[model samples]
Every structure is written in structure tokens, then in C-alpha cells.
Target: MWELRHRGAAARPGGEAASPPREGEAAGGDHETESTSDKETDIDDRYGDLDSRTDSDIPEIPPSLDRTPEILKKALSGLSSRWKNWWIRGILTLTMISLFFLIIYMGSFMLMLLVLSIQVKCFHEIITIGYRVYHSYDLPWFRTLSWYFLLCVNYFFYGETVADYFATFVQREEQLQFLIRYHRFISFALYLAGFCMFVLSLVKKHYRLQFYMFAWTHVTLLITVTQSHLVIQNLFEGMIWFLVPISSVICNDITAYIFGFFFGRTPLIKLSPKKTWEGFIGGFFSTVIFGFIAAYVLSKYQYFVCPVEYRSDVNSFVTECEPSELFQLQSYSLPPFLKAVLRRETVSMYPFQIHSIALSTFASLIGPFGGFFASGFKRAFKIKDFANTIPGHGGIMDRFDCQYLMATFVHVYITSFIRGPNPSKVLQQLLVLQPEQQLNIYKTLKTHLTEKGILQPTLKV
Candidate 1:
């Protein structure tokens, strides 16, 4: 029976063999005494019929589309299961790299579109799961209400983005100007409309399910959409902000898998059985080095180092700026041990890359807990993956489970530690105000400047 189970586990692609008995549990040993014989017989009685069944009694499982390739099938049949997984993962990695380069070449706008696209897909996967679970409950307009809420939220966020970043163009259109003027009021109205519709659609028996799904959708929005907005904010700071943290997570994920595949033995956590301590530690060092190197390479490019600024004269997002201290190379004193071993007194490094070490460490440590959280969610729902959007990587949510957490961390880190006053954004906001409001701000600024002696009192009036 044990041999049959082992053979079945080996035949499967993921190598989920049953765990062996611990050190003292061998058959016919002193451990199985007469006193325990009755208990053992009761266990056998419960499942003894299964041992009599032949292999023919079990139905053969059909092949999936993924296993249709003859070469892959033969390799899986011949090579080690780990090797087969490596081959598939390697191909997927290459494909992802190709897509990444293509998007990067297309520039920041394309990357924004890609992010928005992923957000929509992730939202779809999550909402679909909700629908599938509650479909039988026969709730009225559940999916519609969820989508309406999504639209309302997106309208509010995107409307804010346009008003803040595209102030010049917005002033040109009377309709947009009016909308921007009453943006907050209009957004609130839209949300209220959706809320009313949901309340009206609530059926008597399905009220509990409807409310549960409502909360689920909102929580999903908070988790996926809100974090994605932060990611877009990171992108506006510089593509590097969006890229480095994301890349660091991806690097950590890949390196962890690689290390774990070859070296992992002891399980790291109950939530994810495949995770191991060896992988976590190995991935940490590798991600740190990779993050530093990537940050260094990106700092040299103006396209990455400069923030995304709108130029009214050119009517486009422009990248042009003197490199900030974060990107500039600065010397740091080395430790005494390093100074003695043919090392220089100081090492020149980009301050941004130094920060990348913190980001990478978070990605390696705390970021994965986000994935584990998703894993627990899936287990509770009895699903394998979120959605098979990526052939090997599961859903966008699955792939970006860590990235979302990393994105929020990067955004907060920048806002708290790195970001300075964005005179342009502030100026844009000021421009969006009414003429009277603008005048008040102008007077306030003038008065402040005069008090500071930057503006002469005689020239003011």
C-alpha cells in the first residue's frame, strides 16, 4: 500500500509524496505492543478494505493541456520532477523577461497601462471567485454592483490623477474644468448612487451573502486597487521606484525557489509547506546583491532617475532633472576588517541602492507573508491557484502578492524618508483652485515670502 502511494506521488508532477513514519514507528516493532494491537486493529478495520483494491480499480487521470507537448511529457517521464519544473519555469522566466523589455522600451505610459491591465485582471479573478462561491445564493446584481463600485472607485482615483498632473490641459476643456472643480462632490455622488443601487437590490433571504460579498469586494479593492495606486505613485516618482522594488521581489521569489528546489529540506511555515528556511536565507543575500546592482545600473539612466513631469509646452510627460542625492554616488567609510584586506578607505555607492537593501530585505522577509496570506485564502476556498493568467505563475495576484506589499512599503518609505516637496505638483494643485482661492494662496505666499525677507516690503504693494 505504501509502495502504491509512493508510486502515485512520483507519477504526479509536484512530488507530493506522503510523509514517512517517524523514527520509532516501524511495523512489527516493540512499539506496536499487544496493548496497542486492538487500537491498531480498529484503525485497520476502518480502512482495511482499501488495501485489497487493485490498481485497475482506480481511474486513470487525463492529461492537462500543459502536458500535451510530447517533449515535455517525455522529459517529465524520464528526468527528475525538479528538472522538469526547472525547464518550464525557465521558459516562463524568459517569456516574462521578453515582455518586460518590450514594455520598458515602450516607456512609462505603456508600463502604466500594463499595471492598470494587471489590476483589472486581478480584480476580475478575485470577483470571479466571489461570484463562483455565492452564485448559488441567487443574489440580485451582485457582480454588477461589484463592477459598479470598482468603476466608481477608479473614476475617483483617475480623476484625481488627471486634475493634479494634467492641470494645463484640464483648464482648456470647459467640461473637464467643471468636473475637476467639483471632483470631490461628484465622486461622492457617484459612490452614493452605487450604494443606493446595492441597497435597493438587496433580497430578503440573500442579505447576509450580499453583505458578505460587498465586504469581500471592498476588501479586495483596498488590497489590490489601493496598493496599485501607490505603485503608480511610485512610478511617477521615477520608473526606478516602481521597477526596483518589484524586481527585487521577483528576484527574491525566483532565487528562493531555486535555492529551495536544490537545498530545501525543513519546512519553514505551516501555511506554505514548500517554503523552507534555507530558501529564505539564500534568497535574502541574493536579492540584496541583485537589488544593489540593479539600482546602480538604473541610476545611470535619466529615463529612470528623473521623475515623470508633465511639460505643458511639449504636451507630454518629460524626464529631465539633475540627479538627486539618492541617485548620486557618495562615499561611505568601510569597516576596519574590510580596510585591511586590500580594500579602499571608502566605497562609492548610490544612496538609492543602499535603500534598496532595506526594500529587498523586506521583500525577502515580510513581503512573502503576503503570499502566504493569499495561500491561506486559497486553501480556505479549496482552490489550487488564484487564476491561471500566467501559465506557470498562477494569477497576477499570485505573482504580485509580494509586489503589492513591497509597493506599499516603497511608497511609505519614499514619502517618509526620501521624497521632498514637489513644487510642480503643488503648483498644479494651486492652479486647479478657483480664481479667488488662487488669489488667497498667492497672497499667503507673498506675505510669507515678505516676512522671510525674500520679497521686499516696498515692492509688494
Candidate 2:
């Protein structure tokens, strides 16, 4: 070690000196004093006490890796150059941005797969971290199973399916039949998958067995986001579905981080110690602006870039779908290629789901809560970033936490409020019912509505 640097010193410097070198002493006699430089070199090369050993027999030297200052060091040593730090961070940011846009460009319907991927990875990190902080334990295989199952049957209670299956169900003569028929298999599948996950978690012994079961909520949230995205994708153009939520949520996240970095002063929540109240409020409002921007853009070009995926217009041909219809749907876990060809002609497509603007906004306002919630959980466990996978950014959980909850909320909202607008009675009244049947039903409703002609947008029959 330290001895390696001297190269033995013909090379030996500091030996013993009497007074000064005696007259006629070997020229090397003074070498021992010169040995201070050798000692310095040894200290530099082998991480020794050179700062203290100024007179030691070692060569003068540069600082070693351990001696390089930290971020605040201010000095620029080859051992800790700012350029290397900046270069690494820049490359990492570039990589994440590239990935973000790659998913963006892949049409929305298709990107459900990506959403699913993020959900699984992000949730896996969250759940595993809980175990790490609580018991310093690693639960590997069970976590993998949780992710796999979460991805597989997420749409059980949801009626998600390939585009065409969903389209054909809605476009056919029977509307009520469409919903009832699809839910039969899906409901069972949903419960069955849930049961399986429950059993698996118990049998495999993921840490905090009961809590692991509770973590199913994470799985549920993940599923919900996937289904929500599918609906939005189907209702609007695939692009908007991808663009709206992603732009709103991720943009807000970035904005918050940036604002917090520069302008943050007041603390928002103890859960997020570094989170600034200013940043939070700034981010929340900024998200609304982004939502408006998204809506405006999607609504503007929807006609050209997006064609309707479906419509209630009863035409056999496809038209763009609405958010309500798209979100409530639960499709089979059919592979894309198979489903694509099978559902091609039968399904509808849309230029954009303008209704999603409302839905996306709902997702936005509620979105910050998702981040807050995850932050709370992390702080409760006293864990830092989920992992160091992303250089400047935190782990997948850090990135997608908001989207998971926001997407779930939006999906649920669309299913209830936006999609199920009881248009079927209105549709039936306007269609080819038998004259007698039509007359009877019309007569019954006519008196009521006629009395209440206040309904300016009267039934069209």
C-alpha cells in the first residue's frame, strides 16, 4: 500500500541525519530531507495522512479520491470534477425524457401496455420499500407475483376489452344487453383474480401479510389507471388519452419540483418535508392551465388527427367513442395483434374525446392528493427515494404515484357521471319502434313532457 508508492527509493529518502550531511557525505545524504516529497506522493497515491505528514518521505502529490470534496467543495479536482457530475445527470434526464415521449408517441390505446408496465414497476417498488423500512427484509418472489397478477386481470370489475369487442357491444341493437353480457364474465374474473392474489400473498408470505393484502389497493389503483386510460384512448384519439393525463400529471410534477427548487420557502406538509406550500399551490393551478391547454388542443384538431372511435349515432360504421363508454369498458386480456384484427372492423375510433377535458381536469385537481398520499406513506416508513434508477428523478413510484390515483379517480368518475347518461330511453324513443308500441310509450311520456314542455330539448321521436 503506502510502501508501494516509494518504489523503494534508491530511492530511500528520510533515513537518519546527524546534523546536516557530513562533509563529503554521499549526495544521497540530503535525500532523506528530500524524502518529504516522496512521503507526500505516498499519501496522495495511497490515501494516507499527507496533510499532517508534510515532512514524510513521499513525493508531493495530488489528492486521492477520498480527499475530493463533496458537492459544496467548490474546488475542481480531477477526482471530483463538476463536468462528470453534470454529464451523468444530463444523460439521465435525456434518457427519461426520451422514454416519456416514446410512450407518448405510441398511440394511446396501445400505450395502455406502457401504463400497465409503469404501474407494476412503481407499485412493486412501493410495496417492497415498505418491507425494507419495516423489517429490513426483502420479499422478492411474492412481489413479482403481485405485479404479474395486477397487470393480468385488472379489468375484472371493469369491462375493458379490445377496441372492436367494445365497439360491437355498444353498436349492436341491444344496449342493455351489451353491459349485462360483458359484466358476467368480467365480474367473476375480477373476484377470482382478487381471491388468487389474496391466497398467493398469504401462501408466499410477503412481509406484513395483512398489509400486503392491503397493498392490493395499490394493485387496484394501478388497474384503475389502466382502465381509465383505455376509456380515454377509445373516447378520444389514442394520442389525447396519452397526452391529457400524462401532460397534466407529469407536467405538474416537474413544475412542482422546479418551483420547489427555486422558490420554495414554506413547508406544505410534514409528510413531504421539502415540499413547499408555494410549490404545491403553484403546481395545482399550473395543472389547471395545462388541462385547459390540453383540452383546447385536442378539441381544436380532433376532426383531422382523430376520427371518432364510436358514437351513439346508431350507424353501423365506427365513430369515435365518448369518455363514458371508453372508461366503463372491461376488455379481455387478449393480445393486441389478435384483438386488433378481430376488433378492427367492428370497433369505432375517435379523433379525440373532448369530454375527457372535463374528466382530465377532475383527474388533475385530485391528482396532487395522490402524490401527497404516497409522500405520506413514504415518510411514515422513513424511506427516501424508492430506488436510484432515475438519476435526478426518484424511482418509478415517485414518478407515477399521482397518475395511479388520479387515473383511478377519473376512471371511476367517468364510469358514473359521464358515460352512463341514460340516453337509451331517448334513443329508443327516437328509433324504429312499432307504431302501436311507440304510440303507447310516447303517449305515456307525452302527457308528462307536454305538461312539462319546459323540456325545450324535447324528445325527438
Candidate 3:
């Protein structure tokens, strides 16, 4: 039996320790298979079971994502109705219009203060835009220096100094007469500016280059500031020197913008895609016609009707100085040129009116360049606009870019063309004449005065 079992065991692949020399394990029997099953169960129990778990780290979104749209709708529904919007808009509009008049009422002083700020803003934007366009300046010093220089420009241009300088240099009449008499200080100021810039730019050896940018910055500043100077001077001089040019520029910008937005059909240039040919045509024509009307209305046909100082003070100085039938002439030494201007001022607190027509015409024809230049600059930098400070407009630069150049034009026009060589030039010319000839002219002038009996009898001498 033992021999037979050993033979059977040898025939099997595994021993008793491996599962089965039992019933059903050896052959195929029913209850014998139960024993084999029991053995397999016991063997399985000896080893520990593994707990099941998902290996995925990503979470699947449930239907909860659908809530987003509903949330947004509910939020929007919370806002005020259309009536409220209208009320808000109306209030804002009224506020804006009132502010505009207030600014105009402040007159030249307000305009000048705003101009100084605008210049600094303009220069800095150019520098910032330049960096993006060219990738040239990367150093901190360059930026700092530029800002510093801009501040200097703002200060210099804010006062009478700049206009005084413009009179001295750029607008210097062929006859050597300046609109304002003192210009030496203005010249000195310019030199100081140049030196300051030179020294400031010396940081990090970013020297000897980019004259185009350099010139552009200075010229823009100089031009804008000088315009302010002229306008302010003319304002104080009791003239509407500023009103004409400012109005013309604003009119051009506003008209073109409105027309272009509505009916623009053809692009004026690739750089300025929105400024249409139609807008240009409309703006130009409107500006020209307006110029003529403005000229007539403002100048009152170049005839200012106003009561004279003497008329107002009929009882004051005239009555007091009627003694002895021969006056001391008030010991006045006002140069003939000054006398002429004073005489004019003496008559009116306002200036000549002809500039309105002249300005309107000039602005309509040549002022488009201001818009074009700003457009080109914006395009060059791929910026949507210079800035968003103004509502419909972009920034200080956008509003005033053309004005800068226009101021130069007007200043030049008034100083060189409109006013003619200042009445002062006549005096300068008189002073330079040969002594004998000048003496004869003087004697003739005195003789005429005496003949008119305007001269006092001075001891019959």
C-alpha cells in the first residue's frame, strides 16, 4: 500500500504541503472535492486581503457647472433699471458742461496751469512709448533723467519767460522788434535747460544719440509752452489772441471726430485707419466757414465800440490837470511803440478781432496735421491711444498735440505777420536814423503839435 501511495504521490506534481493528496484532489470525486475546496479556503485565509481603492487623482465635474450662467444672470438683474441709467447719465452730463464753463471762466490762468501739466505728461508718454517701439532704453537713469528734464521744461514755460523768449528768438521780427522787450533772460534759461539735459543724460553713457527723439521732445515742449505764453500775453494785453486759435483747433478735432465716427467711408491713411477722407473734407469746410463768421462776430467788423478811459474819468485827471492853460505833459516817457499799444489798451480791454477769421482759416487748412501726427505716433507704438484721461478723447496728448504746433503757428503769425513789426520797431528805426535827419523829424513833429496847439507854450522857447 505504501509503495502504491508513493507511486501515486510521485505521479502528482505537488506534495501534501501544497494542497492535496486528499479526495477529489487525487482524482475526480464529489465529497472528495469538498475537502480540496476547504484546503484552498484555508490557504487563502493565511494571507491578508487588499482593500480596493481608485487610483485617479483628477476629479470629474458634476452637473454643478451649469450654475455659472444662472449666477451671472442673477447678478446682472440686481442692477438698476434703464430709467436709473438715464438719470445718472443726465446728471453726469450736466456736471461736465458746468465744469467746462468754469474752466473757460478761469481764463488764461487755468489754461496755462493745465498746459504745464500737459507738457510733462506728453514728454513722459513719448519716452515710455519710445521704449516699447525701439527697445532702446533699458536703464533706470534714462527714465529718471527724462522725467527730471520734463519738470524743468514745465517750470520754464509756465511763466512770461517762455513767451518773452519766443519774442526774442523764434518770432524775432525782421526789423529786430520783439513782441516783448526783455528776452535775454529767456535765452539764458534755454541754455540752462540744454546744460541740465546734457548733464542728466550723461548717466550710464547713453550719450551722443537719438537726436530725432531729443529734438522732438524739446520742440514739442517748447512749442506747447510758447503757445501758452503768447495766448496769456495776448490775454493780458486785452486781446482775444488765444480764443481764435483754441476754438479753431477744438472745432477741427470735434467736427472731424463726430463726422468720422458716423460717415467715414474711406481711410485717410493706413497709419490712422479711422480718420476718413469724408471727415477731413467735412471738418475742413466747416472750419473755414466758421472762421469767416467768427472773424465778423468777434472783431465786430474790426470795430470795437467801447467807452474810453477819458470818457469814464472825465471828472478825475482831466479836470484836475486843467490849470495854467499849459500842462507839464505828465512827464511821460512812454516810447512811441509803447504809446501806441497803451493807447490801444487805453481804448479797449479787448484786442483786434481780425485774428478769428485768420485763425479759423489757418486751422482748417493746416491743423489737420496735428491729428495726423498724433495718429501716426499712436500707430507707431501700436497703442490704442495716448491715454484714457479724457472721456471721448485719449489723454492730454491726444487733446493738445495739434495745439502745440498750432500755438507755434499762431505765435509766429501774430508776431511776424498779423501785428506787423511791433510799433516798437518804428521807434527802434527812428533811433537808428542819422542824427541830423532824426532831429529834423523831431522838429517837424513838434511844429505840427504846436500848429495843432496841443503843445504847451513853454516860456515861448
Q: Residue 330, candidate 1: how far off, in angstroms?
A: 1.4
Ranked by TM-score from best down, the candidates are 1, 3, 2
Q: Which pairs clash in the backbone of model 1? A: none
> How high a TM-score does candidate 2 get?
0.51
TM-score of each: 0.81, 0.51, 0.53
Q: TM-score winner among the candidates? A: 1
By lDDT, the candidates rank as 1, 2, 3
Residue 166 displacement (Å), model 1: 1.4
Q: Which stretches of candidate 3 lie over 4 Å from their true place?
A: 1-98, 131-137, 151-216, 237-239, 295-355, 420-457
Q: lDDT tens digits, residues 1-461, model 1?
A: 46744754564436566455568775554234432543434543444454354535433322213532566567667767667767777777888978998998888888888888888888998898878765644567888988888888888888888887889889878999899889999999999998999899765334555678889989989887888888888999998998889999999999999899899998999989999999999999999999999999999999998998878888877889988888898999999999998568999989988888898889888989999999998776667677766655666788888888888999999999999998888888787678999999889999999899998886535
Q: Per-residue lDDT for 287 in model 1?
A: 92
Cα deviation of 326, candidate 2, in Å: 17
Ten contiguous residues minimizing lDDT sum, candidate 1: 59-68
Local distance difference test, each candidate: 0.81, 0.53, 0.53
Q: Which stretches of candidate 2 lie over 4 Å from their true place?
A: 1-99, 130-152, 155-159, 162-242, 303-366, 412-461
Local lDDT at 306 for model 3:
16
* Superior candidate under lDDT, 1 versus 3: 1
Give one digit per residue, the lDDT tens place, for model 3 in 278-369. 88888887776676555445444211111111112232101112111111112335567887877642322122334455677678667778
| Tens digits of lDDT, candidate 2, 348-437 | 322234455565555546777777787776555455566555644567777766766655555565466544433533453344445688
* RMSD to native, candidate 2: 23.2
Q: For candidate 3, give the lDDT of residue 216.
A: 53
